[model samples]
Target: MKQAKRKKLKKTHAPTLWIGLFMMGLLVVLAVLAPVICPYDPLEQNLAEFLKAPGAKHLFGTDQLGRDLFTRTLYAARTDLWIMVMAEIAPFIIGISLGMAAGYFGGAIDWLVGMASDTFIAFPFYLLVIVIAFASGAGSHGIFITYLLVGWLIYCKVARGQSAALKNSEWIAAAKILGYSNIRILFCELLPNIIPQAIVLLMTDMVGLLVIIVTLGYLGIGISPPTPDWGTMISEGQTFMTSAWWLSVLPGMFVVYTGVALSFIGDGLADRFR
Candidate 1:
């Protein structure tokens, strides 16, 4: 039966997931080593080499300012990875805690959390992110603030449902009878059960965050000048797209690559649970 199950999983799961995991791992390593391995300062400019096409000295070519696109692209990965981590962490913690509490307790707490989550959800998702970014002022700080303010709803909703379902389980009753503190029961028992599903959701949400981050950058409401952001790069590259397709295409590809990798990981996790 064990061998059969393994075979079943292998047959059912797409190869894209493994490929995505591999790509994601590679990107992480690249992001980590970017500063050390990058060929040039992403911000350094040489008008002499401006708009040069891919060659031995410069791989992804040069942007309008003659900054090496290769270097900028590598560094952009680091910026994006940092943003993704910072933006996701707060939401994960706060959302899970509120969700667990609301689900387990299910009274005023539930009503309050439900209302807040509903309010956030009612707004068009990307529009809310854009509004928050513009209102808070554009940059990493603004994006982080926006994500913390609203990103929790997705995780909270998922965790709430899971917690509600599990709250009355036999083991929960046993834990209560044994005098487990509410805090201990919620954190130790309920949290552990909800995490697997939450993780899948987290991976998917990261992709959305990446898109929002890029979109903000593209719209000039995100990472500021001299910072190598994929969206910013794409925005800057658009004017020269006819003459230098690589300018926009290469950085945009990085966004696509990361998104695809994350999507595969999320899909893989969902499939595993199924």
Candidate 2:
């Protein structure tokens, strides 16, 4: 029965995972090669060509500033994707470590983790992020700081639960019996098990984080001008919705595309883990 289930899983895993990886990989490649493939500089404006509709020359049309929307969108991918990946690194490490420690130690450490996470959880997540980002001042710095403050709570909670459950398992008990130090046991035993779930969550969390980043940019508080963020592009394009709809619509579509790709990866990982 287990062998059959394993085979079934192996069969299903490749399609979803590969589709997602291909989509995401394509975006990353385009973003990386934006300078080489893009016909115009993302920031360079041409008054004569301003608001040109999508043509052979400008695949995504031009914005009001006459900059190539296609170029800016590609470059924006570079910025947004970089932030999406970079922003998570610190939180991932901190959240997993703290969560593991809390679950493994389960005394004052647990209490503190519980208190901190609960306190943060009390506020609405996006609301809290917006408030923090606004207070921190609009830019990448604010976004990073906002996430650093609140992003880890979900990971911490997930890790804590998994760790708490595993702490009493045979392997953990055996580690203790073998005279392994707490640190070694936590990293070697607990981490290996907990990390799978964390990775699954990481894939999903990135989607939400990307939304937040785009939202902040829309609100005039993210990435800043000349950076060509999707949110900003959407916001800017909204003004010309009737005349030049592609300005907003194309970027928005890209956002949806990226989100879908990430969701596929998360779903695939979840199935694999299960």
Q: Please tell me which predicted candidate would have the highest lDDT against the true structure.
A: 2
lDDT of each: 0.90, 0.91
lDDT of 2 by residue, 1-274 (tens): 9999989879978688778999999999999999999878888889999899999988888999899999999999999999999999999999999999999899999999999998878988778777877787777888888789888988999889999999999988998999999999999999999999899999999999999999999999888897889999999999999999999999999999999999899888888788
User: TM-scores for all candidates?
Assistant: 0.94, 0.96
Indicate the TM-score of model 2: 0.96
lDDT of 1 by residue, 10-52 (tens): 7778675687789899999998898888869988989999899
For candidate 1, what's the RMSD? 1.8
Off by over 4 Å in 1: 1-6, 11-17
